[model samples]
Target: SSLIGYGRGDVRNTVGNIPMEWYQDYPHIGYDLDGKKIFKPIRNKDELDEFLDKMENPDYWRTVHDKTTASDIRLSDEQVDLVHRLQKGQFGDASFNEYEIHSCSSGPIVEKKKILIPFSVSKMVHAIKMGWIKPRKPKETTPQYYDLWAKEDPNAILGRHKMHVPAPKMRLPGHEESYNPPPEYLLTEEERLAWEQQDPEDRKLPFLPQKHSCLRAVPAFSRFIHERFERCLDLYLCPRQRKMRVNVNPEDLIPKLPKPKDLQPFPTTMSLVYRGHTSLVRSISASPTGQWLVSGSDDCTVRFWEVNTGRCLKTLEVGGAVKGVAWNPNPAVCLVAVCFESTVLLLNPALGDRLVVGATDQLITSYEPPEEDKEQAVTWALSEGPEHDKGHRLTLTHPKGVKQVVWHGKGDYLSSVMPDNTSNLQVLIHQVSKRRTQNPFRKNKGLVQCVSFHPLRPYFFVATQRCVRVYNLIKQELTKKLTANCKWISSMAIHPGGDNLICGSYDCRLAWFDLDLSTKPYKMLRHHKKALRGVAYHKHYPLFASGADDGSVIVCHGMVYNDLLQNPLIVPVKVLRGHQITHDLGVLDVTFHPTQPWVFSSGADATIRLFT
Candidate 1:
């Protein structure tokens, strides 16, 4: 693990301790050890001088320096010279015979060597005590620091720099009173005459015309003349005026007056009867009698509950994401339509049996009889024509996934909003009937996130990316479009009376507007922390429920008065929370039972919850 090493050794002279040459024999210094060379030692000053002279030469110094330097070692001048000279110039025969340099250089020499020391606490302490290091003191307080300290003290006397406050009444050239007219002299006699002579129509009065007589003289004069003439004429014509004779008796002349109608006061508050699952709820539907409640949720199930008991009567598993659940208007059968991601199932809740009405693989089929008897016979007889095989064939109807399917209250039609797989931003409306008519309500250009038919009106509201379009079913045109200034409409719900519409947006705001006015939201319910997914209006109460990505369902009350001109009186009546509700696991849909006060919410967690 050690990368570098340092040690101490013996040499009589120290020019800088660095390796020179290998030594041999006992007491050897510069000579290689474990060899034949013995310690002859430098006998006198002359021998020492000769050795030093050999080591000092620059040419000799370079050779030793090259070896130590190339190996990343430090070398002394004397040692460098000796090694360099030994490696320089070819050895002559006389010089080789005259002396053996290694033997002469070897000697018993004792030299103190310094070794590198490791840093430790003791070393640091020693360094500090030896005055090799200085301790630093903390810095003085900064201005901000002093200010904070002063704030803590409360009673500390502080010194503030002198500041010059300018005089309050500094006179500017135009503001000086010397050139301005005094109060009394503002109007000169000649100026007053000129003003008085000006035409009343051309005059610009300081106060309103009625406040002063300067401009009111003509009107007042006209009124006075009219009153005088009216008085004189009344007196003059009183005697000569013709009088009509009564043609009938006073009793007959008096006709009967209709009686005044009594005013009926609206109810101030309505009762909210919460009845559904004990867990998170997704979608809810009420029976035709407005007695029983049905709700579906991410719990992968639908639950039937008694509206008055708040009791969960039956829970049935649909085995998929339960988006919407609705009760058939028929009170006896209590058919519940549950919509899954790829399929919609019509469930007989009474029998606990479910039938898949439509699926991704099942295509919508239209049956038609042949135009003529011969054509019908040919179609019946042909085995392989385009129109031959028409019975009991599965067709893929919805290419894009079905998000929601709502049936008209009267069961005259069933409408489904399906996302276009080619573009989720667009939605296709499919209506089912014996005679399937093209949706008189044209398809939306932007993504239709949600669609709901008005409870009473012949219009259904469709929420798009930037606007809410109300389509008139009877007129077959978009009756009104509510634009939300670049805000994406995430969900929409119509008031029970079908007079108002509530919309949730990606901007984390809930808005309601009158069906007739859409320029601005009348009531803005701002409570959701994220984009709202679904909104449901209570059938009996003034309350509405909205579900957001925050894993919470918020109930806003009193949204009926919301018009573009009035702020809706909305208050959060309840909040339901359970899952983490991440970006992907946002609550997707919500619905309220028409008869009961139950709410249901479907979330991305693949679980649905029923809340009362």
Candidate 2:
């Protein structure tokens, strides 16, 4: 074997076996009497004797350490010593002085020195001297556990000091508790009475965790918990609320609209009840002359009645329920166009104006017109609707059912919507004289809510769920895509000036969009209590109205000035509430009178109201 472990077998690690005198005489990488390091070996007995002579004078010193032997601050030796002594100091009274931990909270609960830094004076002094922070004054000490434990001696070897701590907690008495203590010992008068009022059956066992009300909400615990824990949680996260602002004053670009206070209040009266339909009325229209009011119902009939009287005038059995009705504005010939199923019937109500068509059952059974007039009478119908109606009838095809219908300014063009299915067509426009139909959509978007044609220009608007698209009719290209930033478009009313449009949404928002003021709605009204069903802009007045399913109507003045720089006026005029809700349904439609401030509203309650 090599001499590395010759006959030793790990016993070489024993240090006690060596002579202490020889260990002392060795100069093994240590300092001399003058505090100078010496690492050289002793080669002879004389050198060993020299080392032993040096060792006779013991030398003790601490190492001057550095983080990396590089000083950015270039601290002096005295400063380094001061830092070291400051670290070792407990109370900033003396360097390297010992301090026994004392806690006023629970009679010196912690005997460890480092755990008492919160109550130390040196920590605050070091923060003031080195960190440039103002030292916090030490508070007078009060021992919380002095009553439970024996009084502590302030002059003892272990240092004593005060500490901030909560009041002593309530605990179950020791094993010596032989009887139930009075309520006064544990609870206040109010708590004692509340505890006494508790039913014996609902009382829980003692000593186990008890269910209590919220800490801050419970008045009994207000002394201990002054604020709710939610305040602290709110500091970390915010809460949600309505972001809309009401009663905001308009800018100087516009002024408030003035109205007469003595005029007939809205919801004038139930002057007449036009009720002849067996089912719900889906569409209602007043003639351009305001002489006759026409209505379509689910009972498969289109009825015309005198607007002044409740008497029914004419009822045409188109063999299906009526969905839409509109009167051509040409006074030379009053054309009553009706949409039943997918077909539009153009009936000349002028000749048969005297007697109601369905006044007697025989009128409906024998109301066949002459064969020569059938071609012009049944003007236009979708190829999909009423396939059994035999005759050479003028017809136009549509992709879906027509929900709403509107006439152009000259009564030459027509626009209608089909909200159900937009597979091939969303809006259809038909030219009566040319007998040609044009569909304005190329792709199926969301549920098409409504469509309106420009009064004079060659453009039309189609409103989908959240967006409204404007397209030029002649060029067959989109011109503008207006975003309402609302949920589910419900209705739209375009201004006669052709520069602004107002939209109502199911989110209870009334948004006004300006073509010149940007595609986004410039102003929004979000005060409706429920989903808005219909909206209308008066033809001659500056008034605009929005109706909701909550049976309330809000009228706002939305007249934008002629000047480009002036802001639009949008002051809420009034909230007319007189319609009665029926079977969870309210106002279904609202329309403004073309010539007057009067507005007509239809509700699910089977009543039509004329509000002037």
Candidate 3:
């Protein structure tokens, strides 16, 4: 039929053919020429009948396949015969079952069964794969029927078997009550009777003493025990029973000798030699001959004194506050170098002569360059001509002024260190020649507080805030640098032997270091109560002197080969008090005679004292 223009009510065109739309939804089923579901083609009716028979026998077919088809849609007799032949192996005479044929014809009915009844299909498939679902034997029953018969009286069968029994209770005769005793009566009746059976005197037990208490009563107890035990033994009963009397002697105690009498006290007397000033004295020095002593002071002048007589011989006015006085080593003539606030005046006390070198502008009448070129060229001048020299003569212009001026022992060189609170250290090194070869030694990072040249060497030592720099004049180089433990190293002195160096610091400690060793100091002399400002070594003896801001000059004696622990010697032997002369005071300088054991010390009290 030429079917065309079909509508929703077009039954005539789709009567015997499956619609294409329905076939699209159920593509696995066979479709008619029109592409619509006509019938689900079954290739194995026998396998389906066998599966339905098994399910119907268990009353599960109504729940599984009743919704798909009714028995009224029967197969033809030919189809039935074909199914029987397929089931009973009549078609090929091969040993194949209906389930196997169904499984081979259908793409995967087992997979469909797995999706529908997963648990049953999985168990059956496992049994079939393991050969457990084979045809039943002729005399054996199936496991399903056997299991159904076995569950008939499961509870009765379990009841007939004996069950496990708990263990019987064990009642110990006396332990039952013993495990929990009565609190009111802890001891048992037999125990009480046994305790009562003990002797009354023993029951009232002897009090055992503690170890310490027994020790305290040992002596008395020992005597009593000895007496009683001796009496009871009676081996040597009475004295009268023996023919001769026996004597028992006690141990003899040696007497202690009385301590020897202490050493008798020695009378001490100190001799004060020369003291001839009314105000504070700042510095002192002894002449190289040990005959003359020079002292400078705030009194603005220096006084020369005889060593033996303690008499003042000369008084020269060095304008400004005199801070330091150093004596030259010439005997017939006494040369004194005085450090004033703004000037350094070299004087010959015997000749009443003075050479004023460093002059501040405030102390000068006029600031004029020397008219004569030879006179104008004072420092580092190569020639005596004015045209060639360009350096100006160094004039000290410090307000606080020149603090110290030291003359070399040979009298050929003079050094002056001035503090101006600036980066440059005002050091003037003048060669005292006919034609002056003056060189300014001016490389100090801070204020140069103290300077000292080695006693017999050309090496000079300078003390600053932190370190001591040793400069070698021969090598023209700084040879060594030493870290001073004291922050402000105010004073330094070289030992007479030149092996040891002593430095005093603002920390009130005098430390002595061996020049040969730069490590820790050998010894520290802590006698000063305040900052020690002056230190001088004795030229002859092993003595040294220290002057401190506490207005005291201490003469320390015996710093020779002596150990502080075994033979302590470097202690103050004499302390010269300055408070009697001034209240707020300090000692500026101290010196010893080159030959004698005399000490000369000057302080802020404006007085110099000679001590022996």
lDDT of 1 at 236: 78
In TM-score terms, which candidate is top? 2
Top model number, lDDT: 2
**For residues 561-583, could you state the per-residue lDDT of candidate 3 as single tens digits?**
53334432354456666433356
lDDT of 1 by residue, 26-80 (tens): 2533222233323435434477775785788555433221221122234556444
Model 3 TM-score (2 dp):
0.48
**Could you tell me which 10 consecutive residues in candidate 1 have the lowest summed lDDT?**
374-383
For model 1, the superposed segments whose C-alpha errors exceed 4 Å read: 1-320, 329-333, 351-397, 421-443, 559-568, 572-588, 596-612
Please give the lDDT score for candidate 1.
Answer: 0.55
Clashes by residue pair, model 3: 18-36, 19-36, 279-605, 279-606, 280-604, 280-605, 280-606, 281-603, 281-606
lDDT of 3 at 287: 68
Candidate 2: regions farther than 4 A off:
1-271, 351-399, 420-422
Q: Sorted on lDDT, highest at the top, how do the candidates line up? A: 2, 3, 1
Instruction: Give a tens-digit lDDT track for model 2, residues 486-573.
Output: 9899888888888989999988898899899899999888968888888888777787888788987777767678999997867676
Quote the RMSD, in angstroms, for model 1.
41.0
